[model samples]
Target: MATLFVITLIATAIGSISGLVSGGYDGLFLGASTGLVAGVAAWAVALMVAQWRRERRLNRYFSQDGPVAQHVRQNQRS
Candidate 1:
């Protein structure tokens, strides 16, 4: 997504600048690599958390005590 791409770019820029300031060419590569990995991990975690929350909400909505279930029960008696 756009959010993930933006996060990755920001992280890479930060890492590259820091490495350039502290060390040299080698440090730049190392910092960029580390930043990329961190960005992807963060994105993955965000996706998982979103999915979990969605599933939880759906489960609650469809449960026996939920509105849908109540409506179904009402129709059954008619």
Candidate 2:
């Protein structure tokens, strides 16, 4: 998935940078493992946040005070 790829890229970049700063390939491997965990965590959080926002928007759209509800009320009056 695109989400996974983006997260992995970012994680890899951070891991590689940290690894290079600390030493050689050993650091790189450690950083990479850390990055993988971080990326998956980030992706999960992102998914949760997105779903929450979408549900909220849908609820609002159908609520009595929402635009669609107001439009229906106005049409009924006419």
Candidate 3:
């Protein structure tokens, strides 16, 4: 959230400054780098693992498919 925004800002500033000082568009290019993509890849891996765990648990307990599994509990009972 806020941390990500700050990180992106820092990347953009550093890239821009270094690029302007030495090369050109290096700032913008670096700013848009895929370095953060590695982090995203890790997060994706973790999320996939968590999803698998959840699916295993659901299969064991519910023995049900989707839609039904996603069936949220009723909050307002008649």
Candidate 4:
């Protein structure tokens, strides 16, 4: 989390600086804001992707014969 914050700050600084040089005052502010928003958005997206991957892995493993499945099956018979 600390690393992410540092990286985000560094990226924001670079974006803002580049914006100031390439564009104008408005660009600097907007670029910094945009960098922060984009960084958080990307993190959110990555989290969702990781969660989906974990769910997929779980589903795949569950589809195989295992103790959990066996227990479930045994319960269903009772």
Candidate 5:
């Protein structure tokens, strides 16, 4: 969440500055809006990827061939 905010702020600042330099007031608004959308999209994609990776890791950890499963099997044999 914090990272998302930071990314949005940086993108908006960059867009606003560029727009101000190229097209004045109107450009600033357009650039800021575009930047905001892009930032949010980027953040969403990043979040999804992070979630997917975490789920994959957790699945692996709990799978039959995983360390936890092996430990349980060894304990049962004893």
Candidate 6:
């Protein structure tokens, strides 16, 4: 999350610089704003994907034949 935010900031700055070079004041502001929005959206998507993968990994550990579950059963018998 933090990494993504940092990336977004960097992207926004780059966009602003590019716009300034290519056009002028109007381009600079517009590019910066557009970059910011795009960055945030990208961050959100990354966060969601990370969360989904984590959930999937956790669920695997909880499955009947998973190592964690097998360990639990052995401990119970002991």
Clashing pairs in 4: none
Off by over 4 Å in 4: 1-7, 71-78
Per-residue error for 28 in candidate 5, Å, reads: 0.7
Question: TM-scores across all candidates?
Answer: 0.89, 0.66, 0.41, 0.65, 0.83, 0.81
Q: Name the runs in model 1 displaced over 4 angstroms.
A: none
> Which ten contiguous residues of candidate 5 have the minimum total lDDT?
33-42
Count of clashing pairs, candidate 5: 0
Model 4 deviation from native, Cα RMSD in Å? 3.0
Q: What TM-score should be assigned to candidate 5?
A: 0.83
Q: lDDT of each prediction vs. the true structure?
A: 0.88, 0.87, 0.58, 0.79, 0.90, 0.90
Task: Report the C-alpha lDDT of model 4 over 1-78, residue by residue, as the tens digit.
Answer: 566566678778877887888789999998888777777776677678979999988887787486678889999999
Better of 2 and 5 by lDDT: 5
How many collisions per candidate? 0, 0, 1, 0, 0, 0
* lDDT (10s digit) by residue, model 1, range 1-78: 789879988888888878877779988988888888888888888889989999999999999999999999999999
Per-residue lDDT, model 4, residue 60, is 70
Worst 10 residues of 3 by lDDT: 69-78
TM-score of candidate 2 versus the correct structure, residues matched by position: 0.66
Worst 10 residues of 4 by lDDT: 1-10
User: CA lDDT of 55 in candidate 4?
Assistant: 96
